[model samples]
Target: AQSVTQLDSQVPVFEEAPVELRCNYSSSVSVYLFWYVQYPNQGLQLLLKYLSGSTLVKGINGFEAEFNKSQTSFHLRKPSVHISDTAEYFCAVSPTARQLTFGSGTQLTVLP
Candidate 1:
Protein backbone atom coordinates (compact mmCIF):
# COMPACT_ATOMS: atom_id res chain seq x y z
CA ALA A 1 0.00 0.00 0.00
CA GLN A 2 1.08 3.57 -0.60
CA SER A 3 0.15 6.95 0.75
CA VAL A 4 0.91 10.53 -0.23
CA THR A 5 1.31 13.71 1.75
CA GLN A 6 1.11 17.25 0.48
CA LEU A 7 2.94 19.32 3.07
CA ASP A 8 0.97 22.47 2.55
CA SER A 9 -2.78 22.76 2.37
CA GLN A 10 -2.67 26.22 0.85
CA VAL A 11 0.03 28.16 -0.97
CA PRO A 12 -0.30 31.84 -1.79
CA VAL A 13 2.20 33.40 -4.17
CA PHE A 14 2.49 36.67 -6.01
CA GLU A 15 2.02 36.60 -9.74
CA GLU A 16 5.14 35.72 -11.71
CA ALA A 17 6.94 34.47 -8.62
CA PRO A 18 8.54 31.09 -8.38
CA VAL A 19 6.54 28.49 -6.50
CA GLU A 20 6.99 24.95 -5.35
CA LEU A 21 4.49 22.42 -4.02
CA ARG A 22 5.95 19.71 -1.84
CA CYS A 23 4.82 16.10 -2.03
CA ASN A 24 6.08 12.94 -0.41
CA TYR A 25 5.07 9.32 -0.65
CA SER A 26 5.51 6.17 1.38
CA SER A 27 5.36 2.72 -0.11
CA SER A 28 6.95 -0.66 0.33
CA VAL A 29 7.30 -1.17 -3.38
CA SER A 30 7.92 0.92 -6.43
CA VAL A 31 5.13 3.20 -7.48
CA TYR A 32 4.19 5.69 -10.15
CA LEU A 33 3.93 9.31 -9.09
CA PHE A 34 1.67 11.89 -10.64
CA TRP A 35 0.63 15.51 -10.28
CA TYR A 36 -2.82 16.68 -11.32
CA VAL A 37 -4.23 20.15 -11.44
CA GLN A 38 -7.90 21.05 -11.15
CA TYR A 39 -9.10 24.42 -12.24
CA PRO A 40 -12.26 25.90 -10.84
CA ASN A 41 -15.39 24.18 -12.19
CA GLN A 42 -13.23 21.83 -14.23
CA GLY A 43 -12.05 18.31 -14.05
CA LEU A 44 -8.56 17.35 -12.94
CA GLN A 45 -5.88 17.43 -15.56
CA LEU A 46 -2.58 15.66 -15.69
CA LEU A 47 0.20 18.01 -14.75
CA LEU A 48 3.18 15.68 -14.62
CA LYS A 49 4.14 12.09 -13.97
CA TYR A 50 7.11 9.97 -12.93
CA LEU A 51 6.75 6.41 -14.06
CA SER A 52 10.21 5.48 -15.28
CA GLY A 53 13.24 6.98 -16.88
CA SER A 54 14.45 10.48 -16.04
CA THR A 55 13.87 11.61 -12.51
CA LEU A 56 13.11 15.08 -13.73
CA VAL A 57 9.76 15.15 -15.48
CA LYS A 58 8.17 18.14 -17.15
CA GLY A 59 4.48 18.63 -17.62
CA ILE A 60 1.98 21.05 -19.09
CA ASN A 61 1.62 24.68 -18.04
CA GLY A 62 5.36 25.08 -17.58
CA PHE A 63 5.39 22.90 -14.50
CA GLU A 64 7.95 20.27 -13.63
CA ALA A 65 8.87 17.85 -10.89
CA GLU A 66 11.88 15.89 -9.79
CA PHE A 67 11.48 12.43 -8.39
CA ASN A 68 13.85 11.45 -5.61
CA LYS A 69 13.79 7.73 -5.00
CA SER A 70 15.87 7.82 -1.86
CA GLN A 71 13.77 10.58 -0.37
CA THR A 72 10.48 9.27 -1.72
CA SER A 73 9.55 12.73 -2.87
CA PHE A 74 8.17 14.21 -6.06
CA HIS A 75 8.02 17.96 -5.63
CA LEU A 76 6.46 20.23 -8.26
CA ARG A 77 8.12 23.48 -9.25
CA LYS A 78 7.26 26.40 -11.44
CA PRO A 79 9.75 29.18 -12.11
CA SER A 80 7.07 31.77 -12.60
CA VAL A 81 3.39 31.41 -11.77
CA HIS A 82 0.62 33.33 -13.42
CA ILE A 83 -2.85 34.16 -12.17
CA SER A 84 -4.23 31.53 -14.47
CA ASP A 85 -2.11 28.95 -12.70
CA THR A 86 -4.24 29.10 -9.62
CA ALA A 87 -5.76 25.69 -8.98
CA GLU A 88 -6.01 22.69 -6.72
CA TYR A 89 -3.02 20.41 -7.09
CA PHE A 90 -3.08 16.79 -6.10
CA CYS A 91 -0.24 14.37 -5.62
CA ALA A 92 -1.01 10.79 -6.45
CA VAL A 93 0.80 7.49 -6.26
CA SER A 94 -0.15 4.22 -7.84
CA PRO A 95 1.23 0.85 -6.93
CA THR A 96 -0.57 -0.69 -9.83
CA ALA A 97 -2.65 0.54 -12.71
CA ARG A 98 -5.85 -0.15 -10.84
CA GLN A 99 -5.01 1.29 -7.46
CA LEU A 100 -4.14 4.89 -6.75
CA THR A 101 -3.49 6.88 -3.62
CA PHE A 102 -3.92 10.61 -3.42
CA GLY A 103 -2.84 13.34 -1.08
CA SER A 104 -5.10 15.84 0.61
CA GLY A 105 -4.39 18.35 -2.17
CA THR A 106 -2.80 21.79 -2.17
CA GLN A 107 -4.69 24.87 -3.20
CA LEU A 108 -2.35 27.26 -5.02
CA THR A 109 -3.59 30.80 -5.24
CA VAL A 110 -1.73 33.27 -7.41
CA LEU A 111 -2.19 36.82 -6.27
CA PRO A 112 -2.03 39.89 -8.47
Candidate 2:
Protein backbone atom coordinates (compact mmCIF):
# COMPACT_ATOMS: atom_id res chain seq x y z
CA ALA A 1 0.00 0.00 0.00
CA GLN A 2 1.06 3.60 -0.60
CA SER A 3 0.66 6.52 1.74
CA VAL A 4 1.37 10.26 1.51
CA THR A 5 2.47 12.41 4.38
CA GLN A 6 2.66 16.17 4.79
CA LEU A 7 4.84 16.92 7.79
CA ASP A 8 3.90 20.55 8.08
CA SER A 9 0.36 21.58 8.82
CA GLN A 10 1.03 25.28 8.29
CA VAL A 11 3.89 27.45 7.11
CA PRO A 12 4.26 31.22 7.35
CA VAL A 13 6.66 33.13 5.17
CA PHE A 14 7.25 36.81 4.51
CA GLU A 15 6.89 38.22 1.07
CA GLU A 16 9.95 37.53 -1.12
CA ALA A 17 11.14 34.80 1.21
CA PRO A 18 11.91 31.31 0.09
CA VAL A 19 9.70 28.45 1.23
CA GLU A 20 9.58 24.70 1.03
CA LEU A 21 6.58 22.51 1.77
CA ARG A 22 7.72 19.07 2.78
CA CYS A 23 6.03 15.96 1.41
CA ASN A 24 6.98 12.35 1.89
CA TYR A 25 5.49 9.15 0.58
CA SER A 26 5.78 5.41 0.97
CA SER A 27 4.80 2.73 -1.48
CA SER A 28 5.64 -0.77 -2.54
CA VAL A 29 5.22 0.08 -6.18
CA SER A 30 6.53 2.96 -8.25
CA VAL A 31 4.58 6.12 -7.56
CA TYR A 32 3.79 9.22 -9.59
CA LEU A 33 3.94 12.30 -7.42
CA PHE A 34 1.94 15.48 -7.69
CA TRP A 35 1.55 18.83 -5.99
CA TYR A 36 -1.73 20.67 -5.95
CA VAL A 37 -2.54 24.09 -4.59
CA GLN A 38 -5.95 25.34 -3.49
CA TYR A 39 -6.55 29.02 -3.05
CA PRO A 40 -9.25 30.34 -0.79
CA ASN A 41 -12.62 28.96 -1.88
CA GLN A 42 -11.13 27.57 -5.09
CA GLY A 43 -10.68 24.11 -6.48
CA LEU A 44 -7.42 22.24 -6.29
CA GLN A 45 -5.13 23.20 -9.14
CA LEU A 46 -2.24 21.11 -10.34
CA LEU A 47 1.03 22.79 -9.55
CA LEU A 48 3.56 20.24 -10.75
CA LYS A 49 4.11 16.55 -11.22
CA TYR A 50 6.90 14.00 -11.43
CA LEU A 51 5.75 11.19 -13.66
CA SER A 52 8.96 10.14 -15.37
CA GLY A 53 12.21 11.23 -17.04
CA SER A 54 13.38 14.19 -14.95
CA THR A 55 13.65 14.28 -11.22
CA LEU A 56 13.24 18.04 -11.20
CA VAL A 57 9.82 19.01 -12.47
CA LYS A 58 8.64 22.57 -13.06
CA GLY A 59 5.02 23.52 -12.70
CA ILE A 60 2.74 26.53 -12.95
CA ASN A 61 3.04 29.62 -10.74
CA GLY A 62 6.80 29.44 -10.25
CA PHE A 63 6.62 26.20 -8.34
CA GLU A 64 8.84 23.17 -8.67
CA ALA A 65 9.38 19.76 -7.12
CA GLU A 66 12.04 17.11 -7.12
CA PHE A 67 11.25 13.43 -6.97
CA ASN A 68 13.76 11.52 -4.92
CA LYS A 69 13.23 7.81 -5.31
CA SER A 70 15.61 6.72 -2.59
CA GLN A 71 14.07 9.06 -0.07
CA THR A 72 10.52 8.61 -1.28
CA SER A 73 9.98 12.33 -1.19
CA PHE A 74 8.52 14.94 -3.49
CA HIS A 75 9.04 18.33 -1.94
CA LEU A 76 7.66 21.58 -3.37
CA ARG A 77 9.64 24.80 -3.34
CA LYS A 78 9.40 28.39 -4.39
CA PRO A 79 12.38 30.74 -4.47
CA SER A 80 10.37 33.78 -3.43
CA VAL A 81 6.99 34.11 -1.82
CA HIS A 82 4.18 36.47 -2.73
CA ILE A 83 1.00 37.61 -1.02
CA SER A 84 -1.08 35.87 -3.65
CA ASP A 85 0.71 32.61 -2.99
CA THR A 86 -1.14 32.09 0.20
CA ALA A 87 -2.98 28.79 -0.18
CA GLU A 88 -3.28 25.20 0.95
CA TYR A 89 -0.95 22.72 -0.69
CA PHE A 90 -1.65 19.03 -0.97
CA CYS A 91 0.73 16.24 -1.92
CA ALA A 92 -0.69 13.25 -3.71
CA VAL A 93 0.65 9.98 -5.04
CA SER A 94 -0.70 7.63 -7.63
CA PRO A 95 0.81 4.22 -7.80
CA THR A 96 1.01 2.24 -10.98
CA ALA A 97 -2.52 1.40 -12.12
CA ARG A 98 -4.02 2.71 -8.91
CA GLN A 99 -6.05 5.64 -7.73
CA LEU A 100 -4.63 8.78 -6.16
CA THR A 101 -3.70 8.92 -2.50
CA PHE A 102 -3.65 12.35 -0.91
CA GLY A 103 -1.89 13.67 2.14
CA SER A 104 -3.12 16.13 4.69
CA GLY A 105 -2.69 19.62 3.27
CA THR A 106 -0.22 22.30 4.26
CA GLN A 107 -1.54 25.82 4.70
CA LEU A 108 0.88 28.45 3.42
CA THR A 109 0.45 31.96 4.74
CA VAL A 110 2.42 34.77 3.12
CA LEU A 111 2.70 37.65 5.51
CA PRO A 112 3.15 41.22 4.38
Candidate 3:
Protein backbone atom coordinates (compact mmCIF):
# COMPACT_ATOMS: atom_id res chain seq x y z
CA ALA A 1 0.00 0.00 0.00
CA GLN A 2 1.03 3.55 -0.70
CA SER A 3 0.25 6.77 1.13
CA VAL A 4 0.50 10.45 0.24
CA THR A 5 0.98 13.56 2.28
CA GLN A 6 0.18 17.09 1.17
CA LEU A 7 2.30 19.57 3.11
CA ASP A 8 -0.29 22.29 3.07
CA SER A 9 -3.98 21.90 3.64
CA GLN A 10 -4.79 25.39 2.41
CA VAL A 11 -2.82 27.64 0.16
CA PRO A 12 -3.78 31.25 -0.58
CA VAL A 13 -2.09 32.90 -3.50
CA PHE A 14 -2.63 36.13 -5.37
CA GLU A 15 -3.59 35.87 -9.00
CA GLU A 16 -0.64 35.50 -11.43
CA ALA A 17 1.74 34.53 -8.70
CA PRO A 18 3.83 31.40 -8.79
CA VAL A 19 2.75 28.64 -6.47
CA GLU A 20 3.99 25.23 -5.43
CA LEU A 21 1.88 22.58 -3.71
CA ARG A 22 4.11 20.12 -1.97
CA CYS A 23 3.42 16.40 -1.97
CA ASN A 24 5.33 13.43 -0.64
CA TYR A 25 4.69 9.73 -0.74
CA SER A 26 5.77 6.50 0.89
CA SER A 27 5.50 3.07 -0.66
CA SER A 28 7.17 -0.27 -0.34
CA VAL A 29 6.93 -0.92 -4.05
CA SER A 30 7.24 1.32 -7.08
CA VAL A 31 4.36 3.68 -7.57
CA TYR A 32 2.83 6.09 -10.03
CA LEU A 33 2.07 9.59 -8.88
CA PHE A 34 -0.72 11.93 -9.95
CA TRP A 35 -2.04 15.36 -9.30
CA TYR A 36 -5.74 16.10 -9.61
CA VAL A 37 -7.72 19.28 -9.31
CA GLN A 38 -11.40 19.67 -8.51
CA TYR A 39 -13.27 22.84 -9.14
CA PRO A 40 -16.42 23.90 -7.38
CA ASN A 41 -19.10 21.29 -8.02
CA GLN A 42 -16.85 19.28 -10.27
CA GLY A 43 -15.17 15.92 -10.31
CA LEU A 44 -11.48 15.25 -10.05
CA GLN A 45 -9.52 16.28 -13.14
CA LEU A 46 -6.05 14.97 -13.91
CA LEU A 47 -3.55 17.74 -13.71
CA LEU A 48 -0.35 15.76 -14.23
CA LYS A 49 1.18 12.36 -13.71
CA TYR A 50 4.57 10.80 -13.24
CA LEU A 51 4.55 7.25 -14.48
CA SER A 52 8.05 6.97 -15.92
CA GLY A 53 10.65 8.44 -18.26
CA SER A 54 10.80 12.14 -17.50
CA THR A 55 11.39 13.57 -14.09
CA LEU A 56 9.57 16.73 -15.03
CA VAL A 57 5.99 16.23 -16.17
CA LYS A 58 3.72 18.94 -17.49
CA GLY A 59 -0.03 18.97 -17.46
CA ILE A 60 -3.09 21.03 -18.35
CA ASN A 61 -3.66 24.65 -17.27
CA GLY A 62 0.06 25.39 -17.25
CA PHE A 63 0.75 23.05 -14.36
CA GLU A 64 3.79 20.86 -13.90
CA ALA A 65 5.44 18.54 -11.41
CA GLU A 66 8.82 16.99 -10.85
CA PHE A 67 9.31 13.50 -9.55
CA ASN A 68 12.09 13.25 -7.05
CA LYS A 69 12.92 9.72 -6.12
CA SER A 70 15.49 10.71 -3.55
CA GLN A 71 13.05 12.91 -1.71
CA THR A 72 10.01 10.72 -2.37
CA SER A 73 8.21 13.78 -3.59
CA PHE A 74 6.12 14.88 -6.54
CA HIS A 75 5.40 18.53 -5.98
CA LEU A 76 3.01 20.41 -8.25
CA ARG A 77 3.87 23.86 -9.50
CA LYS A 78 2.43 26.65 -11.61
CA PRO A 79 4.40 29.67 -12.71
CA SER A 80 1.38 31.95 -12.71
CA VAL A 81 -2.08 31.21 -11.48
CA HIS A 82 -5.50 32.49 -12.47
CA ILE A 83 -8.70 32.91 -10.55
CA SER A 84 -10.07 29.87 -12.34
CA ASP A 85 -7.20 27.83 -10.92
CA THR A 86 -8.70 28.08 -7.50
CA ALA A 87 -9.71 24.60 -6.54
CA GLU A 88 -8.92 21.57 -4.43
CA TYR A 89 -5.68 19.83 -5.36
CA PHE A 90 -5.00 16.26 -4.49
CA CYS A 91 -1.89 14.11 -4.63
CA ALA A 92 -2.38 10.44 -5.27
CA VAL A 93 -0.16 7.38 -5.47
CA SER A 94 -0.86 3.97 -6.94
CA PRO A 95 1.35 0.97 -6.72
CA THR A 96 -0.37 -0.95 -9.50
CA ALA A 97 -2.39 1.79 -11.14
CA ARG A 98 -5.44 0.02 -9.85
CA GLN A 99 -5.89 1.39 -6.36
CA LEU A 100 -5.01 4.88 -5.35
CA THR A 101 -4.30 6.41 -1.98
CA PHE A 102 -5.06 10.09 -1.90
CA GLY A 103 -3.94 12.84 0.41
CA SER A 104 -6.27 14.96 2.51
CA GLY A 105 -6.27 17.57 -0.28
CA THR A 106 -5.01 21.11 -0.64
CA GLN A 107 -7.37 24.00 -1.22
CA LEU A 108 -5.76 26.43 -3.61
CA THR A 109 -7.51 29.74 -3.23
CA VAL A 110 -6.49 32.26 -5.86
CA LEU A 111 -7.21 35.69 -4.51
CA PRO A 112 -7.67 38.81 -6.53
Q: What is the TM-score of each candidate against the true structure?
A: 0.97, 0.97, 0.98
| lDDT score for residue 49 of model 2 | 91
Residues 1-112 of candidate 3 have per-residue lDDT tens digits of: 7889999999999999999999999999999999999999999999999999989999999999999999999999999999999999999999975898999999999999
**Over 4 Å off, model 1:** none
Tens digits of per-residue lDDT, candidate 1, 1-112, equal: 7899999999999999999999999998889999999999999899989999999999999999999999999999999999999999999999875787999999999999
lDDT of 2 by residue, 53-105 (tens): 98999999899999998898999999999999999999999988769999999
Q: Please report, in order, the local distance difference test score of every candidate based on alpha carbons.
A: 0.96, 0.95, 0.96
The candidate 3 region of ten consecutive residues with least summed lDDT is 92-101
* Of candidates 3 and 2, the better by lDDT: 3
lDDT of 1 at 60: 95
